[model samples]
Target: MSPELYITAGAALAAVVVVILLFKAVWRVAEPNEALIISGLGARRRGGDVDSLGFKIITGKGAAVMPGFQAARRLRLDTRAANLQVSCVTQQGIPVHIRGVVIYKVGDDFASIANAARRFLDQQDFMTSAIHELFTGHLRSIIGNLTIEDLILNRERLTSETRASAADEMSKLGLVVDSLQIQEIDDETGYIVNLGKPHAARVAATARIAQAQRDQEATEAEQVAAANMAAARRDARIKEAAYQAEIDRAQATSRQAGPLSEATARQEVVVQETRAAELEAQLAEQRLQSQVRKPADAKAYETRTLSQAERDARIAQAEGEAQATRTRGLADADAARALGLAQAEASQAKGLAQAQAISARAQALKDNQEAVIAQQLAERWPEIVEAGAKAFGGVDHMVVLNGAQGVEEMLAKALTLGGAGLGLARVLLNGNTPNDSNSENGLKATESRE
Candidate 1:
């Protein structure tokens, strides 16, 4: 029973394995990056007549291929890259060798798939060589139309030119170019290098100039910031010093407060004591005035009154004696005058004889006025000396520095002043002499009395 069962199971398992192998061969699956190109028989046509290739294209799914009746081939649609090297001349007629890479993929559309399948299905490994050869001619054309400057710097112009030069050719190959990159440009005559030299030098110089300016501005800003920092530090130090000074002053004032207060209190006590002393002295003075001065003043007044009355009595007694003497003298003069009148008649005859002699002497004196003035000066010499001595009357003390000589000089100066008066008298006497000689004699006597 086990042998029969084992043989049956073995046969069934082999059949299933063969069927699976057969199904895998007929049922062709297209991967994400590939397309199934089925042709030969019962294959549906796709795209229009212009692009139809009597084949059916399937992508991203499976299709039943009838083995001999219909044949299916896998066409790769993945990206492929090709290296390109070309010798070309730029629009500026500069010869250059360019090296580049072109990235491309088979088209996803049915028409493009059919075209690629027809061309590359048998030679999938030769795709890169085909693309490289094709792109090489297109790159030459592109470089011929563009300047080295555009190729080197203007990437957009380079890309656009590449697209314009290769688009139709790539479409015929059923390939889409994702990118064309120019990797290197070798200038045989150094045309491209020389062309950029001036611009490069100018740009380098401008960059250096800008860098220098920026450096200078940065230095100035740094210096200004340092100055500001120094100023801030100095201000802070000044404020700190001022605050310290204020603190010291406050401390000193606080330390002295107690002593100053005590001194003020002592001064107030002294002032109060002084006021009390002054009030006591004033009270003493008032007591002295009331107890002593009033009584002393009254006693002195009484003494002065008694002395005045005694002096008045003595003056009245002396006045009465003077009146009695004057009355007796008048009586004696009346008697003498009566006796002189009897003798006056006898003297009248003698006076007439004396007048004749005096007239002769007056004529001689008038004839010599100098001799008259000299005689008069001799007669008034004693009176002149007395008048000169009166100059010293009010002096309390006489101190002559030159001793007796000084006293003599002073007396001489006083006598000189008296002589000046004598000259004046002489001038008066001279005017009076012609009119009245007796009047001149009387003026001389008055001068002596003065």
Candidate 2:
């Protein structure tokens, strides 16, 4: 490159740099936190209808400003805080000192910027002092309208009252209050402090009561757990004792196992020996039954048979003798009966003859009963003798107690019986005794003769 061309290029580059710098100086930008106020030049005339200040406002953008004909001023739209302290009285006439902070910013609208630019553009750093003075008067007025209780507890009401009291005046300044906070209050009479004493005491008492109740419940739970632990320990000890007893019993039983086994073996041997002895005894009994018992039973049976046969034969002989005695007695009885019947007939015939003779004699000599009875006796003499002989008809032999004279006296007695029948015949013939009596007298006389 040529030297002249190099100088021309350098000159052109310097001119471009100067133009860029001039453009930068003339083109002012408004940040989001600030507004640019342009006055002088025809730029003010562009927004004079809206703001009536002949100033143009730009915010959050850039505008071309002529260097000398127009001027740009930055009005900060960022938030600012002002501290306020005021001595005031509440609606209840309680004197208090209030300390607060008010947060505010310049309005971002063009008219607000124009209004702010006309008033505070040259003294931006003095904004807090002006806001602090303005809000102090407003806060005093706000506190005067509200009670101490409302100021203490009602933040919304405090804010609303602040806005109501300061809104129009701050609008004239093109400022908006973002917040007005009452940071602290000093009660000269201790009224506000006294107001919270009862609630604080009640909250303290309630907290203490809750803590005591929790402590009591925890103590009771701990005591119950201790009791349960003791009971569990006692039960565990009892169970352990029972298990130990069982273990001891098992060990004792194990220790006695040898003796028990030996006793059982001995018992088994004894039982076997007893069974063998019993078998031998049974075999001996069977042998005795087959040998000695059979022969003894046969001998006893033969002797018993012979004794029974002999006894039976003797019984038969005695029975035969008794039968013969009975037959002989029967034969003698029959013969005696026949002879007695003959004697009775003979006596009856003799009595009848005597009765007929006495009856004939009584008829012949009606007053001579003795004579007639005597004649009946004489006529029945032979029948009397025959009836006396018939009395000995069944006797095979006779023994006279005396000599032949006894025979003569027996004949006389027999003849006297015939005379007794004479008395019966006399009674029959006379018709003084009954016939039955006469027959009875006749039977008596015949029995006497026998």
Candidate 3:
């Protein structure tokens, strides 16, 4: 082991290390985020046909090739985001500024990876900008079929239209869109605001109506609660008053019990005393009736008997006087009848005598010269005086207040009355004529002769 031998060994070891490092350095790796594109000489491909692409694309693995003979390129397979700002007219001819984001990824298939490798392998940093310009024209066509409200509210329709417009164009670029978002919408003519105006106002009015209804219900509930509270208070007061009245009645009954019992006992005692006094008084009255009233009645009956006997004696005396008066009256009547019979006999004789004289005069007047006789009444003066005296003789008293001369004068006048009658007869006889002097008397005379 000399120093020259150690130096040669060290050179060989360094050369082997350099060759391994060079081999490792020339080998290209395809990461999970990218695809590796290899070209220029002896690149192993899967297909035998030469008309197929000559280059090879590999993803998610590593490969070894000579560094000078092979060239390798990388294309990103991971998701990429692009900010899209497009100013274009829609198919409906409305101009709009659409700001959006597109999320895309390179295709994993061999053909799609090969196409992406050729186009964007050297400019991977500028992938987003390229996808933005490509999507601008496609977005215009998509928006043409949509309205402002459909873009804002109907996201599903917006996405469907975007896919229909941009799907084919994006396929050519070897990228698939995971999502497209219209981040901001600018409506130059207030189309979006006016579109939402009716619904916004309706929502605002409905909110106010619901709030007012709730407030009114709350107020009514408050009033009902207050009324219930007042009713409860009134019931409580009524119950308290009823209980107080019951307590007062009970106290009054308790206070009166002793006095009421005493009064009842006193009344019963007074009734018993009154009954005893009535019995005693009845016994006394019965004794007095038998002793005093019976004897007094006997004495009164004896006095009445004596007075009745004395009255009977007086009645007999008065009856005897009445019998004597009746006997005297019968005797006076018998005497008076006898006198009336004598007067009747005298008057009959006088009337017979006067009738005889009148018949004789009438015969004389017819048979003789029918002359009337003149008479002297001096002889008949005594008769005329007797007749005049008899007229006043039946009077019991001659009451002459002119004294003794009046009585004598009355007797003389009675006697002289017959003389006065004689004077009138004398004058009557002076005018008398015989009945035969008349001419009609001749007819009476001739009838008398027959």
Candidate 4:
């Protein structure tokens, strides 16, 4: 090689080594889990806005940081867990020991990174101690607000409340909590143990209840399956029996088909014969009624009619005789009554004037005989009419073949009896006892009525 070429090569190599050294001095790269906070002379943003981050934040990229002018700090963004043990008072005022862990990381945002770089960039190794101290205070504060039961039972609630309470402070510290876990809570007064005892008992009881419900469901399922199986078997047997009975019935019916058919035919024939017999009997009955019974009935009706007519005639005769007899007896009774009245009047007049009383009465009766009779007839009019009506009182029904004429004749006969009574009264008023004449007259009236 030539000397000049060697000198040129040395200069180029020296230039490359210088560039590499400068790059080594100025270049800064942030890992995926880290943020690079470059601060110093040129770290300010464009236009030099006072509100802009004084330090440049780079994440997952390379940045040129001038040595001794711009200082680059790597803020680890990877999660860090800080174990914390603190003694705090719960909401119930029971003093408890709480051991907890806080998983935290540096914020990704420029402001958060700037804040974290400002606070913890110098000593990243002390982050755990800082987080531990920070979480101890936070745990104490949060646990003071929370009951032992809340702490024991509701971890989510406790974590949320803790995050909320520490959010602003952690923002200032440029840290974000990924998880806040309460590892253990110890109660020196046995409050936690006692509290867990009841919960444990309830959990055990609930488990037992669930188990019993499952057992009961299983038992019920078994019983239902058994009953269903039994029912299925019974139904199968019943169906078999029914099928057997149907088969037997079908065979029996097949065997008896001929006989039954014959019997049916015979039954139809018998029915027809019976109907014919009934028709024949009806014909005979009609023939008998027309030929013999009808004529006999007609003859019997004629005989009965003749006998009834004769009986009616006899009854009429007897009734007329009885009416005449009654009318005559009534006339005689009226005459007797008139005699008694006359005697009584005579006796009364005798008391007033004994002499000539009979003569005076006889004279008065002779002079006003018609007036006396009129008065007596008027007074006895109702009685006379009633006596006349008695003639037909015993007759339930009188079928008058002569129609209205016969009715008129019976009325005339009754009126004749009434006239006879009047005649007898007139005879009595005339001071003549017309016994034989009235009797003969009554007999003549009865004969005429008959």
Candidate 5:
């Protein structure tokens, strides 16, 4: 066993059988969403397909396929979906029931993946019921030209009427309808909630007529503010009854004036006691005519002058005794002178009958000179009213100083005291008595024996 150690163990057993036949003639592997379509006999050309179906599409890469001339297949590009249930007829021929969905893929341009791998490769589970019986006869000729409001609000005219009715039978099965969706539409009558109900009842009757005209203008402004508060309470009760009657007429004129000035001061004290009793009855009638008629007219003028001097001495002693007794001496002196002339004619007839009764009482006082001056003014009318009462006898409190010229100067000093008692009765009728001789005096004693 030596020829150099059997040539080094026969070259290590021929390099371990050429590494086990080069790992069984070239190894390979690829996966992850697949693409391993190795064709028969030496497949290789990728990308832009070249010739015969002798191919190679090892996606994520792996190779070593020689087993009996090499061949393999697995082509699934991924995205796909199709659910379409349709029963249709429209164009006013009604009869419709449809529900749809169709999203497709497996055509990233490998010539639309070799035309969907020659029509679904091998009936890929009936490819969604053969695309829902070829889209239910193309959705009944696209709802026969459209009506149901152009299939509910015209979605771009229902996708241009579904691409003008399935674009020539999906281009004879090349297929590219990426989406054709219409989830539901099943109407037999009740049109669409009676189209909208009349415009919502005209917007609810215009909001109830604007709320009844704002409640009648708030009740006529609250009754005109209660009639202006009852006319201001009747003008404040007529100005408080005219200020209480002007305070009761100024308290009744101040109570009459105080009893009219005390009745004019008691009528001036009874007119000063009736003028002092008329001056005491004119001083007692002038003291009874000055002590009883001037002493009885001086004793009747001394007893008539001693009775006419004793009758003239008895006629001179009887004529001297009749001539002394006549002795024949001339017939006795003629009878004594006829008896002394008959006694001197009887004493001159008694002194002419007493001087004719005093000249017939002075011719009846000068023929009744106003009845002797009204009987001497009625016996000296109380001494001419007491010299007119001495001019109010110095009036004690008389204030009649000048009102009416002091009562007309006290009535002209009481008529000048009756003209001084008629000038003292004309000086006692012009003389008389005083100391008579034989005039038999007194009542004027024969005017002093003139």
Candidate 6:
């Protein structure tokens, strides 16, 4: 194991390292997302009947390219985006703004790779700009054929149709569209906003009607409940009155029975006393009996006479009262009938006077509408000025460029809008016919409608 054996081992290791470096320098790898385009010298590829394409495209593998005779270039096969912002006019002559993105990549087939390599091998950085221009023109064309509604609601149609439109062109450029999306559309006019207003108003009207119906139903229910409570109160009062009448009648009966019972009890006592006297003294019995009998008969006769007189008096008084009530009823009926006729006549005369006055006033107004307006405006001038001044209530700042003159002009302009009410009043007073004569007063009428 001396110096000669060591020299032999060192030479073998040097040869192996040189061969590995040479292999690394000659071999080129194409990544999964890229294709290597090899041109010059034996780089031609042969397919079935067609001859070689004059170049070789290697994808996802390694190939040997001679250092001087062959040139290898990479064409990326990864996806790319081309943004399109186009202001285009639709088929309906409507201007629209569209923003979208087109996702594209180089085709995977050999033929597509050949086409791409031939054009983009040296200019891969500008590929997106070229696609952007291509797709921008295509989008304009596509948008020109479809309407705004189609663009908004039928985006899938737009996509498919756009892809179909640019299919041949993209194939020539060796591009395949993975997705074409229309992201935004801006309409300059407010057609879409006004479109839903009618439906919204109808829905609002229906809601209001439903709310009113519910309120009316609630009000009716409340009224019915109030009626029921009042009826209960009335019935309770009637029942109490009936019970009170029964109590009063019972009390009157008790009061009437007291005097009769007292009279009967005194008569019984007198009879007992007479009987006792008869038993005690037989001699005086006859005398006492006569005296008691005579006095009792006299008292009885007086009571009978008084009762007959009182009955006669009550009968006469009742008869007189009935006669007076009947006379008064007859007189009242006659008086009421006369009063009714008088009132009817008075009402008729009053109605005729009112009708005449209304006719006269109407004639005057039709003849002198200007006078009527002048009178109304004169009466309500202060209120009109106050209402016009309310327009600036929310203003926190005021800038007058022309001092008092500017203030006057601003005030006049603001009052003009509020003067719509005055215009409406004049329109009402006149029969839609305006008379423009110079006012006797210095004030001039700047606005008038005829």
lDDT of 4 by residue, 1-450 (tens): 999999999999999999999998888888999987777997875543324767777788899988878787778888888888899899899999988889899887777777787788888889889888777787788888888878888988877887898899899988899888888889899998887788799999999999999999999999999999999999999999999999999999999999999999999999998797667557655664565446545655665676679889978966885675455456666687775556455445434452244446556676877766655554455566568779889999666565444555565577457566666776766655345346445654654443
Candidates in descending TM-score order = 2, 1, 3, 4, 6, 5
CA-lDDT, candidates in order: 0.77, 0.77, 0.69, 0.76, 0.59, 0.76
**TM-score for predicted model 4 compared with the true structure:** 0.45
- Residues 1-450 of candidate 5 have per-residue lDDT tens digits of 679989888899999999778766655564655456666776857547534444666667787777678766666766567787777766777666778787754544445545555677666566667767777777777777777767766645665576557666555454567777787777666443344345555555555555555555555555555555555555555555555555555555456546645655665566665655445445444553454334434443444455456666766655554454333234456766764565455445545666666666566655654555545654455456566777679878655545444444555567456766554664564343233213534423433342
Error of 2 at 219 (Å): 0.8
Best by TM-score: 2
Q: What are the candidates' C-alpha RMSDs?
A: 20.0, 28.7, 33.9, 21.5, 27.6, 53.3
Model 5 clash pairs are 28-63, 29-62, 441-445
TM-score of 1: 0.58
Q: Please, what are the lDDT tens digits per residue for candidate 2 over residues 196-267?
A: 999889998998999999999999999999999999999999999999999999999999999999999999
- Give the true-structure RMSD of model 2: 28.7
Error in Å for residue 320 of model 1: 20
lDDT of 6: 0.76
Where does model 1 exceed 4 Å of error? 1-15, 44-52, 276-450
Supply the TM-score for candidate 2. Answer: 0.60
Candidate number that wins on TM-score, 1 or 5: 1
Q: What would the per-residue lDDT of candidate 1 be over residues 1-450, giving only the tens digit for each residue?
A: 799999999999999999999998889889999998888887876556533467788899999999889988889999998888899899999899988888899998876777788788999878899988887777787778888878888866776777777888778878899988878898999887888889999999999999999999999999999999999999999999999999999999999999999999999999998797667557655654564445545655565666678888978866775675455446666765654553454345445445555666667656876666655554555566568778788889766565444555576687667567666766776676565557445544654443
Better of 3 and 6 by lDDT: 6
- Candidate 4 or 2, higher TM-score: 2
